[model samples]
Target chain A: MTHQDRGAADGTPRLLRSGALQLETGGRLPEVSLAFRTWGRLNPDGSNAVLVLHALTGDAQVADGPEGAHGWWRGLVGPGRVIDTERYFVLAPAALGGCSGTTGPASAAPDGQAWGSRFPFITLRDMAALEARLLDLLGLASWHTVIGGSMGGARALEWAATQPERVRHCVVIASCAASTAEQIAWAQAQTAAIRLDPAFRGGDYYRHDDAPRVGLGIARRLAHLSYRAEPELESRFGRAPQGAETPLGSPDRQRRGRYAVESYLDHQAEKLVGRFDANAYLSLTEALMSHDVGRGRGGVDAALGQLDAVEFFVAAVDSDRLYLPGQSEALAAALPGKPGVEYIHSSMGHDGFLTQAEQLEPQLRARVFG
Target chain B: MTHQDRGAADGTPRLLRSGALQLETGGRLPEVSLAFRTWGRLNPDGSNAVLVLHALTGDAQVADGPEGAHGWWRGLVGPGRVIDTERYFVLAPAALGGCSGTTGPASAAPDGQAWGSRFPFITLRDMAALEARLLDLLGLASWHTVIGGSMGGARALEWAATQPERVRHCVVIASCAASTAEQIAWAQAQTAAIRLDPAFRGGDYYRHDDAPRVGLGIARRLAHLSYRAEPELESRFGRAPQGAETPLGSPDRQRRGRYAVESYLDHQAEKLVGRFDANAYLSLTEALMSHDVGRGRGGVDAALGQLDAVEFFVAAVDSDRLYLPGQSEALAAALPGKPGVEYIHSSMGHDGFLTQAEQLEPQLRARVFG
Candidate 1:
């Protein structure tokens, strides 16, 4: 097996240039590129390949990058971990329409300008199809397992449904087969926050010195709350004033200090705004909003029925409110073999899929990675 | 007893101007006026008086107004309903920091201009105190019962804690003893939305031709979702597209139509923007975020221990995600007598307090009004 440098020395994701791609929405990307990171070596026939997808705002660094840079899923993906890089060839890709070195709205078009307002709408299926092309370029016929959580889970499910023969084991966590009404509503508010920002300039703000950071920050604040459990927030910061800053007792409303929770949300928003692009956020959010495995395939049950060739392993965070555990139950019930949903007990809401992933090690080994 | 036409012929709320009033935050309203609507006649000695507090966006109209204008709580407060107006003189005052005929940011100041940016922060306790003054002017030393839901419930709880002897019975529904961390977080997003709008002008949008309606609309959309249950939304809309318009398949994101749920939220936002003031919304939201029945009076338990003279009746919407049923349970458990929480079974979520009020008629009549 050949050991190739899959990542840059500066810790940037390695880019794979591809040709024109047809989108699920009937639109086309004239040129597409995928940014990815890979660990371990592939067998000569490439049958031991495993694909790891990331959630919204997540990048290709599923495990540790060069120079011991931390990864979001480091606990579950490194050598000697549950995903054991020594045993399987693992590939983690930055999602399409994402800011992390991937081809997104911020990427330049054939005309040498950012796609910006002209970027076409893409769906989770399109993202899965794009990943499939990347795999084809690597001479891989099939994956040992396709696994993800949240938006990543949605993409993993799409892979199973879109190309059933190619995926051996399909693992989905903290996501639904289709976007629920509540999910769409929340996304609508987030996307609206970005669009309403005066600095957004109709998604063509690349040329401007200032971006819609405030609006993006607000969106992040809103999304962060939804990602967390109310009980967890209550126990962590219940109505406490941030430091000595009084949330009340101020004659001037403008001068009033924030509650601890507000301060926490502000911090989360700031962190996201500094690293993310407003247009990319909107693009990815809209794509998730359009997620529906049933679309153009009868319905969810019928779509899953076609995935008989793929073994399913579904899991849900017990306290997940964004993508309710009931959604995972429904998804599990619809799968070919009617697999029972593995529950991950957590106080972290939808984000438990990422934070509580260690709890899934045993079940993942026995049911999916085995 | 003699009856008086409290409301004007123009359907405007009746205003009662008073002398300077001290606020909880140490600020003073040089001159304050309360906009109120009274139904039925006040008996001699005024022992039959019932004070019905309005929610955040609610108004003075608790029942049918002159010429048959509908009230928000008309179903539960009518001539022969649970809160019978014929037997008990009912008064509902538009909340302070509200736009509906109340002294708020839109109200004229001593300078004959709108308060706008000059309005001081007011807490739920301040609102209850103002109503107490209103009661004093009407020759009512105490209320037979002070009943409310949501923000109104917070005010009712405050009244019981602030002036235990003045309120014979306090009925709080779908609210908590203090605003939770999650509640403050949600309110932060809402207020941020309004403040971020370009037309807001830092709460001084009264002089602008375009108010912060767009921002206000976004805030309402977010709030309305929190006001409802996820299951309710899923059952009602469930990935359905709006009439004749597709949420997907549009090459241009700008040209994409809304989902059914998005349309529903848009309708809700439009209705609120047409009737509410942006500055007033911000003021009331801030006040709610500052809500704490125990503030300056010790913790919630110690504060409730002081309300020995006020009988408590608590109720919660079983599916309320915003103010979880557990909050109502906690409030009830902390009350003087530890009243058992009355569960109003409804799938409508937090809005169940209004939409499912009829479900509380039996409990209200037997335990509260009785």
Candidate 2:
């Protein structure tokens, strides 16, 4: 229920306090800890190890979400699945700014208080760097395949660009080499939505009586809409009123209930409200906004040009509006071998990368496991 | 300053309150009134009068902002511009659920109090019907040309189908015969944003000191982003910082400033908050959500098929993501002429229909005025 509870290293999520770490934004952290979960065992040679990264708001629970827990990418990772936990060692770590078992704004600083507004802005490269340390701690010299989608894909691409030798294969899905200005604009609106809430109280609302639930709900609603394609929403809900509730409210009262799509979005908002942290959402979105694989490497092409050693597979959801297929095509065009983008056709938009892995399984298997 | 100031019949902005109006949802409005402005002079037979419709958040201001007031289509509606106010008598009405000089949620009812939450949910057809009443008041028999973009485009299409005899030449830009499911979903998100704002007060926040500006701002931000194309933003801002103010804020504080694109959206939001009412925003947004020209006319084909009496020119922004060009094509195909979609090539996306009149000038003149 509190930031400390998640940062306390509950045994279900093992924690490691990584020594001193310097961030990409020129800020230094005296101590950093990451919460992670591993599936399958690492072979003696470490060649069988595979690192699977989670997207924004996703956690280390890649597959095995027993009980009532929800896993982000359950379709692709598990026993006998495309990821095949039985054959390959899979390690999933909560991203640096993630609230679920990760060292985020909610985590305690060296002074033993929640970082709150003091947590420095981190980037995807910083996440990639910290993840490298986590890999070293596990005695894995190099990852056989570093796979992820969306923000996770940013990290995977960052690793492949800055340190390809450490990754034998890279799979980037539903992501571009850099966050577009439009993407930043959307991220900024979401962050502004959270910050403008009176309940948010400057990202220091950890112990406040009322958190930014309303604001966060609005943020989630906006995000959920963007995550799916318009065609999907049209086909799914159209103009149907929710249940028998009329969309009409009196001149003296508020409008009642909603259209089915509104209810669906509200459901999405509530689900995130119970589990996700607003500050963490803000932090990760900033990190995503800062995502540029070519920031210091001249340009995207030159940056990807340095990843010749990493076998790469670029994939995109054909219906994706958030991360359009053109982005994946652009990424593939800049990659070492100029590989064609593998398209996963679905009505789900950008979410197809996480939900429709059946279409992606063969391509991933051919590139990474074949 | 007050709704009545705009609602009261002054010479510049003409206002009329019709009695006993029934809404699309079967609700009854004891009185319905609209604010409107007209340019040029109507001919003896009213054949030279053109009806111009405004999009969501737009009022009767189609052109001629003498001061520095921001006219939505100022560039395209001047003495000798595309719309040519000098020659054609152009009449624009503030939509029924509008705030600008219109009888909307902010307007006082028969009880002499702000309608606020009590305002009825009106539809695009209802708006067209009301506008028809306004035309009757002005003693205009029929319009020579009917043109609009976006939601105005929706109104134009509705006018063409539901009352083809009233419209001689119809030019629908960046809209379709029906509100697509995707459009509804986006609208739902905007309405939810207003509702979630604690300050919104269930649409009755007119007299409150705080009036859901944050939520409205968020809604505007979401809408403005969609109004523009992603590639345009990427080309213009491209992850650039706003001046030298960084995106990084301390762990104990909120993010300081914004990226260039973020600042742009913020500016757009602030502008709307200053001049627009949130409840009216919600009302007009609902009107847009219910904009299905096909409703009661069977399907889209049947509805568009009924518009044989009116000559139609369907135009779409080549880069529009919100109202795709395909929707325009479908609308044109359903019409008796089967007109090919007129493409306005620009990076402006949906806004292209408003901003890129230079590119569309010759085509529009040839199709609608020829």
Candidate 3:
């Protein structure tokens, strides 16, 4: 498959690089390729740059494609928007351990077969390291701002902590220094579901007739609930029928009353399975589960203590269930100085960073691009 | 166990008959004798009575339980409490699917085997019907008041809607007309986890060496998160470490960190498993998932319209994640005349009905007994 076949969202030239990257799995991933898209013109000094991190299942495309829907972050990265293309050069890279034209399980192995079940375990630090290498290749030393939400937030924190001198400002929204026990528990359960799907076949389902769609759908459904608030779910689909029936004539109900919420969940599942790779989903979720800034460092507090950047903005979603607001507050408090942490209230819950960007733009601009 | 073991907490003679009460599973449950404690004493007419409801896993005892802690609802059952034990003889029957002194899976069958894998599915209607049978045995045609919290609130609601003439004043605290899609989804995941353990053996783990304790513990941990609010969990455990390594070593470490919340979950799981039966927990959790007051009655609006009670008090916990506060408000609004619904602010989430009794007392007094 040629690189052009993948197609860029906004006619931007997609850059592809191949190399060997060491993974936390104690295995070396050789001949890796990263797919990335850039917005705006890089200055002569190549210093006026901002990285736009994407959420789970998102790609480097930040604009609307010729057909289908716009990129996931279309709300925040368009012309004259928060991450405006008129000013700072924007970089949106497909994350490591992902499927969107990036080196992942779908990548070819040294033996000329698909990596499939052989991809090394990826981590947040590894993702940041890859990005840092990309920045180095572009002749840029320090980033003007590193901003992200959700797992992107984790990567942002990793960038600030692992390469402090290379990042001027770190804007982490709706995320935590580390995934909480609750988050890890959910991820673990999702991984189990994916692995148990008969079609998963130890991640070698790439050549099989059936994919682990059921497992991937289950993961997406669970994550979708965390991304949206209970109030939103109830308001949208409270005990409403799905207008469908199961083979047993039980109304095709899985979760109580055949409510429209179940239908919504089904839609999310179907969408994820249709567009995403189950292996990449599993790999990234596992990385999220292993996300502990203090894993090798003393503890979370000690690891956070190493962050000396004065320009730190921690934004929390009040209704976030996965990485609750308190986690963000704790992260903010751990910074050397008392940086002002803000709460972005939205019924969207954890996905508030993507949905309620307007309410949070002032703080984002003041703390990052300002 | 003999009849003496079934006496009231104060050593008084229990009036209700205690027997095996053959289950739908065709098993003769032993050690299933009921320990019923009544308040205000049975009247000669047997009509001046209020049937009190208890939360999930609560027992018939509603006051001081000998040397044990106060019964689950001691605050709401005294002389001047909401139910007014002084004027109305109150009866709180342990739920049919409970692990208390009720006919549950832990009870032995006629062949001297526990009904671990033999317990049939129980529904909310079935539970309310059991209470009806108990009232019938006592020669009472109807109840003056039906009061309950959480699952108890659920039972009270069922009593009012399913048997309107049998229930006059219905007081539901921190309950919903139906389990939301989220609640059902959680319950399904918990059940699936417990059943996934090989030793679970189709719920017949009583004779197995490994009782699927890990699976059950994980289930309880998940349930516990829903039971308490994010604020409560943050305030209580936050990021505090447990200061010890799990016997399972570092894999547990990778997933659970060292947070005190992990320890708290461990404690809750142990408490539930030690005092309760895993099979019964699964059965009851599934039963709760099956609880939909709107099942075959058109929908929630129509089902709630059927409640023709003399008085109605619908209450919900402000931070309840499973059953949103809006749901309780919707239920109250949908009542025949749009009765006043009470809001109880507690950080205990859905478990506020059991854990935050003080927050519920005022609402109970102002709306029920008043």
Candidate 4:
């Protein structure tokens, strides 16, 4: 009946507990626990293991469960699918600062209180290090492929850059070598949105009756818009009023009905706010903002040049406005072998990394898993 | 000094008080006032008077004053500039729901209290109608040209569509015939940010010592990002820390310094929040959300077809992400004569309409103001 036992009852993510962990910022977490889900058994050599990282706001659940419950990447990560879980031991760990049963701001501290505002700042490097620890605990020496998209892609690239020998193949999709100024600017707005909410209480709202749902909702709406293509939004909802609602002519602004697009954003906001923690969102967003594969090694070109031992597969969503395809091209061009950037033709923008991931099946199979 | 007398002594905007003004949404303000500034003397025939409209966050001051005060559009509206104030009488009216000298949410109602929550919803058409009333008061029958950028562009287009005979020339820059789904989505986030601030108090915070400055700041930050180009930001502030402040490695979130881009956004937010009213921001944003020249006039092409007598010159910023160049192309294609869309080349995104406007000088001279 306790928090740690709840997941075990149902076929949910299992926990990996570890001792004090040091962060890249010279801060340290007294204890760390990662919630992870695994599919297929690892081979005796452990070379058939695949590490699947998730993007911001994404959970450890990459593929469907035994009952066929839907997962975010179900299309490419199921039995006999592009990833073919039947042949590979695929593992997906909820991000370190995530709300999905991971050691995040909402998790308990040594004082038995929620970490909340006291949680230390962690970067993508720190996140990758923690995942490495999990891999060590799982008796896995190396990964056949470390693959992801968006923030996940950044993490996958980090895995290859930091521990080149551990990852034989690295697939990064719809991401860049580092967070661009525009990306940082957007993150600033989102984090500001959450912080401006009075209910947020400086990232310590776990004990409060109400969380910063409104602020979190606004952040999600903004993020969702960036995730999709403008043309797709226009084609799907262009100036259309929501069912039975008039978006214009209302004398009272409060009484005015919502536009179809506004309604769509509201739905997206509600879905995220209902399940995610505000502090976790801020933490994860800040971490993504700190993403820089070249931070200590050198510039992006110098850092990527050192990854000769790791085979690289870089892909970009053609319509992605958040992470421009040019970034992916630059990342590919900077790699040791100057790999050609793969294109995922989609009208879904950055989210195409997830929705149109199937488009990269042949490329992924030939260059990565195969 | 009283609010009405303050502007009179300083060569500031002059106010025109009027009786109940009917709005497009069927609402009526018992008393209405428009603050406007004029350059140059009106000819005896009143045929040389040009209407220059300001975009969101801009006011009646379109050109430098006698004291040499700077104006938002000073470059193109000065003595011998493109819009030449010396040759043609130029008039700029503060928008109806603005926080400038014009009557708005912070303005006193007939009952001697701030309108605040009681302020009725107004659209671009309604705003144009008020300017029309201002023209009627000035004894001008028509405009030599009606020109503007961004929201002003929308208003100018509305003028040509609703009262084509009144506008001899219509120049719309970086604007579309209607607010796209993506634009609405962005607007929804901004309004939501303001509304989420507890200090907002259901839009009735005018009398409070503290206004919704935080909410307004967040809104401005989001807006400022959308107004500029991505590459411009990347090239200007690529992961640079602000001054001596470190963007990473601070254990406390509050103590952490900002990324250079974050500092830039903070400055933008602070500048706007200090001078603008949160309610006015929301009002104008929602009004923009209702921008559609074809609302009740069949459709875009049909509405534009009715404006055959009004010469059109449309322009778009090549790097504009908010209002894409394609939207301007579509707008130009829908016009009666199908004027080719002029491109304003700049690295400054949608703001290029203001910054790179000089690029269209020859075209504007030969096709529009000429």
Best by DockQ: 1
Q: lDDT of all the models against the reference?
A: 0.88, 0.80, 0.70, 0.87
Candidate 2 similarity to native, TM-score: 0.90
Residue pairs in steric clash, candidate 4? none
Residue A347, candidate 4: Cα error in Å is 0.9
Backbone clash total for model 3 is 1
Question: What is the CAPRI rating of model 2's predicted complex?
Answer: acceptable
Q: Interface root mean square deviation of every model, in Å?
A: 1.1, 2.8, 7.3, 1.1
**Stronger candidate by TM-score (3 vs 4):** 4
Off by over 4 Å in 4: A1-12, B1-12
Task: Kindly list the per-residue Cα lDDT of model 1 for residues B16-114, writing each as its tens digit.
Answer: 786677888988889888888788667776787888888888888878887789978888887788988777778888888889886888988899989
Clashing pairs in 3: A246-A252
Pairs that collide in candidate 2 are: A117-B250, A117-B251, A117-B252, A117-B253, A118-B251, A118-B252, A119-B251, A251-B118, A252-B118
- Ten residues in a row with the worst lDDT in model 1 chain B? B1-10
For model 3, residues A275-294, the per-residue Cα lDDT tens digits are: 89988997787677567777
Per-prediction CA RMSD (Å): 1.9, 5.0, 6.1, 3.5
lDDT of 1 by residue, A38-64 (tens): 887777767778899999999889988
Q: Mark the regions of model 2 whose C-alpha exceeds 4 Å error after superposition.
A: A1-13, A26-31, A65-71, A109-113, A248-253, B1-12, B16-22, B26-33, B65-71, B74-87, B248-253
Candidate closest to the true structure, highest TM-score = 1
Candidate 4, residue B103: the lDDT equals 77
Higher-ranked by DockQ: 2 or 4: 4
**TM-score for chain A, candidates 1 onward in order:** 0.97, 0.94, 0.91, 0.96
Please write out the lDDT profile of model 4 over residues B26-110, one tens digit for every residue: 8888888888887776666878778888898888888887676787887678677888876777888999999887778899988
